[model samples]
Target chain A: MMSMHTKNINTHLVEIKDYFKVAISVDCVIFGFNDDELKVLLIESDLKEFKGKWSLLGDIVRPDEELDEAAYRVLKERTGLDDVYMEQVQTFGAIHRHPAGRVITVAYYSLVNIEHVELKLHNNELHWHSVKDLHEMAFDHKQILDTCHERLKQQVLVQPIGFNLLPRKFSLRELQNLYEAILDMELDRRNFRKKFLSMDLLMDLNEEEEDVPHRPAKLYKFNFDKYDQRKKRYLGIGF
Target chain B: MMSMHTKNINTHLVEIKDYFKVAISVDCVIFGFNDDELKVLLIESDLKEFKGKWSLLGDIVRPDEELDEAAYRVLKERTGLDDVYMEQVQTFGAIHRHPAGRVITVAYYSLVNIEHVELKLHNNELHWHSVKDLHEMAFDHKQILDTCHERLKQQVLVQPIGFNLLPRKFSLRELQNLYEAILDMELDRRNFRKKFLSMDLLMDLNEEEEDVPHRPAKLYKFNFDKYDQRKKRYLGIGF
Candidate 1:
């Protein structure tokens, strides 16, 4: 008869073998801002079982690929863009979430300026959907999208990350509009300007918007250098 | 000759099989406060390669267990504690971090008050070490510990999670001490008390500390029910 310790070791080995069967994948919630509205890049599902539904851009992590690398690969492969700002938000791993097998997906959210990116839709199936009017998505992607969106909303309040969704030189009105769009609320214009200006993270570009029917507001650029210095001083707290 | 689509499908299948060899594990950074010092529970490394070095309690995640459940299981099996406050901080998956093959570990931090409960310590190898004076740890666990510690520090400012590290009823001085230990800095006593009182998340227990040494301060308990109500009203921003 085997000793209890030996039996325990045997059980551990068997458990390890059983766990090796589960696959890991990375899903990207590619967020973009345009027309003063928040949007997410989604792909038409190719799986026969869910042909009509949309899905966030994702791919299985390869044998040699890291989690972040897999997420970047999905972004680059699907959007034909690189060096985008991305962050891993959470991992979703509910049993029976995937139709194929036990696939655990690490979800990441990427923010990009829609005006800057010319998407190379090789398959003509990828499109940006307004976040406000999302349809049913394949798998648990709806929950994943909501989670990433909530993270984005929370992060925008404390961090200067929301500027990544705007053009290089954007007017204060545009900035306020972007914030209002993301946060889904109205802000007192004077208070908003005062708050951002006090942070000293925007550079007066001495430029103004063109080709607008209404008056073009003075444009300002995000001062990343100043932001980085302030970040070093503050460490954890952000304005 | 195989069509491009068929070739791509075959490559995907092969990649999935290759990735299946990688394993996943969960590591728990069980933080406890005692003797006016922040402590973390650690176990002596059983691996022959690192015999004496300490390691955070961890285990390979079973195929059937969720990531959070796996973390809770490690905390329960090692400390014999249940219903503890645990949260997944981050996933550490540096390719060669683990010596025993390709294992990706999800790191979690748990808070438990040392005086309120007894540690089972079934094995003599487990011990609680001061977080400030920890030496080299086994298998990149030192990095994991630092990450979780940083997260805890950031969270303590915005959330009332630090209360979990103290007794149910604690004095203003004890609460301040706990924050100083976790944040690694001395806070102004009057300011700290003012901030916590303004948040309105503590209830005056009308009690006092019972031990000898000094004039016992008034004790208070965390008002979690009030906190939940405030949380719903404020949504993302926690006081």
Candidate 2:
């Protein structure tokens, strides 16, 4: 019975069993855009201790799941959408971060186009909360949200990941609004348009906004292929 | 027998115990500068299966320790130094990454001034390997190393963390050499010096290199306070 493979298995069993007291979980700060405001999906906590408090949609990761898979699964199960862009932001492992003994959670922020996906809130508790209006949340989830939001703000300027929050065909005005909502700062309109156009990563689709009170702007789609190639060249150089 | 606190504890215990099969660890990619080359501290694997292969300096995170605390402990235990500039780069949690079990590791890279620390290797197996010369590493360490290296390269251009790898007072030439080594490309000396000086983050010590084969270059030190304030202003804006 003590073959090479068997020996390896035994060594793993003994070493792993002793360290199994620590549990791993994943928390997702899923950002969605609706009506020119940045929103995050949250659920009212079912735990009695956190009754009526909002919390990031999360679950204890199963033994068989990859960290990213667990996060994507949480997103899919909550929103009924797949193929959303998600990035792991950070791992939070304060010793008492969890009320349930020694649970460490990895935080991921995902961007989904709100108008594109039909959410299937399984418990009917999930709702999109405006990022600016968020109050205290359950179990250090507020800290997690802040961290992911900071990351999102940082990433939007450099990477084209912000496109995930917008519809496929979006006007320049809508793009500027998205940035303003995420950054919480007003950007010079002319400067913003000039900067983005100079990057050469947007395609003029010859389309205009469907409905608007004022003059509708020309529509453009992110040229992902060009962005991908340009991004590779910009790596290691900041901005 | 169960008060409110005890009842909460019991609930946590039951929920957490079911997910205890996952083990967590912290891996430190300790980057150090040696002889104008960017180097990483690695140790020879103790496992018989990986004999002679280099591994990141790491250990299983103890149940009582925070994730960051565990990374710092590994760095201190391995290098015999504290207060080094450390940052968590990313977490790797691929299933089967560890042959022993499903071990998820958070990777951190610490910049240590090699000349400042008296490294007590504990065993002769520990060595500083030039990053460019590293071959296959034990476990998934090569990928981990690459990821951390990429993060370090990206960070040096935007932040003052690279100062942690150099002496307190260094000539512009030394600083450029450090950048060239980390970036693996030759930078124009005059251009590099001009760019850094333009930031106004460096303070001229009015000192020269003490021992040099050629004429000693004028020395300067990074102005930490100015860099800290400047960094906040630069946030959300790409380099």
Candidate 3:
């Protein structure tokens, strides 16, 4: 549904950028789940303004760019990944949070299946740090990460977004672990099993994990079609 | 405390605006509660671009002006009301949500103590419309208002923000009614009483209603001090 209005927006922004010297920016908190832990992607800063400090993936917004495009550009430039599950979480404007002087950062968070996409850090040195194991970050990045983490936790309970952070074929145990990690609470195995199965959003693949130490658990894929059909009837409002 | 950073931001924006033709704007969904129903302030569009259609209380953003200041300015200009308790809920940027091209609107929702704030509309065509009774609005304001309504409901439960929408000293019944109106659900009075009192954020003022046809109810004022202390502990993270 690309409306004619969207074209007008592109042209308008081009004109606005030419006139205004305002430096809009985008910051992304890329989330990846692995082995019952929720991790966020961080980059080592190069700018002398934030030298030697780890920061959320961010950069100045291009003058003639859409907000979402700027966010995606930042992600691609830093992570070498595209078409990942991304959503705008919030915008931070504390006036002086940025040392570059009055730069407003629109924060976007993404849920990427770490197994499918290869992590190519390009020019920036990037690493995945466990949310629990985060140290002091550059600028107001600690606060930005906290906000994105909370949004991710809130979203997990209401939507099937967690699937985006896991492999296409995942075990039931893996799914349970993802929820427990994000919510920061232990779930009763039996109750969790009953609840998720009742939703009928998981399809049995009749396959088992390969190259495991012990007996491998059966694999399953998210039944996106079923979830879509039941979403209207689903009352997944809050925890 | 206004930081030196804010002062720098003010100055930087001034220099940038001299070059850019960008304008700042504020759109307010001034919510009011009366006759046990939730209402929002709206205005008839003056521009030939949106002739005769209803719109939100919005105007252009000023150069070097704080976002909150711009919101309050629009409220005072359109409704002749000042000192309103407004919160920046979210920013909407869908490329074409505005017909005037890519004008990204940062939405601010104000909870006017419908009793304390005067409905002195500066624009003769401005009026308060019940949220449920609203038809098609100019631009994507209907969508923006819906998002604000959700934010208002969520904030009302977790924080004692409802106090800003109601009279300073109000009865428990009135408070409960406000909750029911915003949440759009019938909460048990006993449960509601238990939940709110347990929070320990409201102080009994030991007063009664002035005009009523039924048994007068006792009045209470929100304990802002305790609420502030509780916020330090609670951090507004409620389900």
Q: Which lDDT tens digits does candidate 2 get at residues A1-239? A: 22321122212234446775777888899999888899998887756667788888887777888899988877887677879899998999898877667878899999999987676644526789999998798888999999999888878976788999999999999999999999988998998888888877789999899778989889999998876565365333331
Looking at model 3, give its docking quality level.
Answer: incorrect
DockQ of each: 0.33, 0.31, 0.11
Candidate 3 per-residue lDDT over residues A39-69, each given as its tens digit = 8887676556667777887655444667788
- The residue pairs found clashing in candidate 1 are none
Q: Is the docking of candidate 2 incorrect, acceptable, medium or high quality?
A: acceptable
lDDT of each: 0.76, 0.80, 0.70
Superposition TM-score, candidate 1 onto the true structure: 0.90
Q: Which candidate is the best by DockQ?
A: 1
Off by over 4 Å in 2: A1-17, A234-239, B1-16, B234-239
Ranking 1 against 3 by lDDT, winner: 1
Worst 10 residues of 3 chain B by lDDT: B1-10
Top candidate (lDDT): 2
> What's the number of clashes in each of the models?
0, 0, 5
Q: Which scores higher on DockQ, 2 or 3?
A: 2
The model with the greatest TM-score is 2
